[model samples]
Target: MTQPEVEPVSPRPSNLNLPNVLTTLRIVLVPFFGAALLVDGGDSGTWRTVAWVIFFVAMATDKIDGDIARARNLVTDFGKIADPIADKAITGMAFIGLSIVGEVWWWVTILVLLREWSVTLLRLSVLKRVVIAAADLGKLKTTVQGLALGLLVLPLLDPDLPSWLETPGEVLFYVAQVLLAVAVALTLWSGAEFYRGVWRQRHELRGSGKS
Candidate 1:
């Protein structure tokens, strides 16, 4: 008896879904955010605040896009690729810009950047065999880092704020400092988690191999 031919599966297209739109929006905002931060070379309070708003909006998309994709079953290969790229672009811009403005130490920025990109590359290496979803600790790290960077970017939070807000702003700045330290620590921890996961799945990954 002759065997029947098997049909090939077609990949799902990454249409203009809400989640993908949000992801694209985040990527698009990266350069604008960088420009707003640097227009006055991080000196002008107005531009600094503008940059903060832009950064907040971009980060908000990060929080929502994943939820929307999962809830609506709108996940796509494009999203899988573009989402992380968008994140890295915006967050990397923030780190580098802060370092430029003297708000963040270069060493801290370098350490976080190295870990983030290195882990991302590691994930890609095993993409065919496994998909690593973001962990709770990773989410927390991002949240803390975003808040910390926002505080650092808000130039008006210092002596420029009204007396009523100045005290609160100063307090928040100090809080941001603590959060940043915690964020860095969490970053390293989550990266360790990723490697541990990969180690645990080594046998499965080897079996899966390449297509």
Candidate 2:
């Protein structure tokens, strides 16, 4: 018997919805990635390398999924919401795991995670009334985060990696650290703009008796 065909998540219809599948894959991989981090604890080279490879692939998926979704017109509310949540989970868990192993600066992880959570809350509070899509700065922030996380993850499991141009981990660490700081700034700025938009939307709607 032919099975029932399920509808895709996006309101826009397209068979080339690669982004949705990639986002789904990222969600599925988060737990395994966490487990790998635990197993690679205490700076074990082999396990760290394995963890990094998996993380790299997962991070790559983050970019690919979004691009595919946009290109294929499969941008759904589900993808809009869940994709960022999945990113934070994977990145946040690794940040915490890396700190636990004393590989990353604990304060750095705390600061970054705080920014992530704050911006997430701000977006959630306003997503319903406004389209809180990624601004250019936010997209740049994600790129910065992907690079920084890669550097951070590598050192946690394998310290031999030279992050930027031709520098060692120590040098690359600070560079990625700076980029993370910048990303946080961008996140906050963009978030505030989004909040203002939502506030305006709500006020206007209420004035029109639409709310």
Candidate 3:
């Protein structure tokens, strides 16, 4: 893997590349996901299933692109920026959409959203000076969220999920909640660690001062 000299992942894949395109497609689907939930006029209701499936597929792309990029060594500068944006758009909309529909409390939605947006901005700030990619915790959080969101949307797809598994909605919701909580903790921890790394390296940079 050829690393960027100054910035490890600098000049990452461009927005027009395959992975980034997938990310943009996912972001574009957020509104449709919300609309499929909020507004229903028979046919609109049918679209809910499609929306849910699409949501999961979109989320799947997130997982796929990263793996492909890393395994195939196709990671791009644009992927770095676009991937997280896709994540926030999808998650923020779902959380807020559920709140708007009175499914989950707005407070919960806000909490999740605040963590997501804050961490995103934090990454932007930290990445400007340092080169920290997504960490284990962040990945864990995304897994939980994607599963939770998929399950939550599943109900919309099929209100009666396999007669045996009762209370699937609540089950998935709580599971996702737990995962998100863990994710939040990790996000905060990673953010702190990133800053600490930056702080420690500040003097080292001054000593070298190679541009």
Highest TM-score: which candidate?
1
Query: How high is the lDDT of residue 179 in model 3?
Result: 64
Clashes of each: 0, 0, 5
lDDT of 2 by residue, 42-138 (tens): 4565566566787888888888887777786777777777788878887887788877877567887888788788778777766776565667877
Q: In model 2, what lDDT does residue 85 have?
A: 85
Taken over the whole model, the C-alpha lDDT of each candidate is: 0.86, 0.72, 0.68
Please, what are the lDDT tens digits per residue for candidate 1 over residues 1-211? Answer: 9999989986665678899999999999999999999876788888888999999999999989999998878888788878888998899999999889887899999999999998877887777677787888888888888888878888845456678988787888788888889989999999999888887788676778733
What's the lDDT for candidate 2? 0.72
TM-score of each candidate? 0.87, 0.75, 0.72
Tell how far residue 118 is off in model 2, in angstroms. Answer: 4.2
When 2 and 3 are scored with lDDT, the better candidate is 2
lDDT of 3 at 58: 80
Stretches of candidate 3 exceeding 4 Å from the true structure:
1-15, 41-45, 156-211
Candidate 2 stretches with Cα past 4 Å from truth are: 1-17, 121-126, 156-167
Clashing residue pairs in candidate 3 are 12-76, 12-77, 13-76, 13-77, 13-78
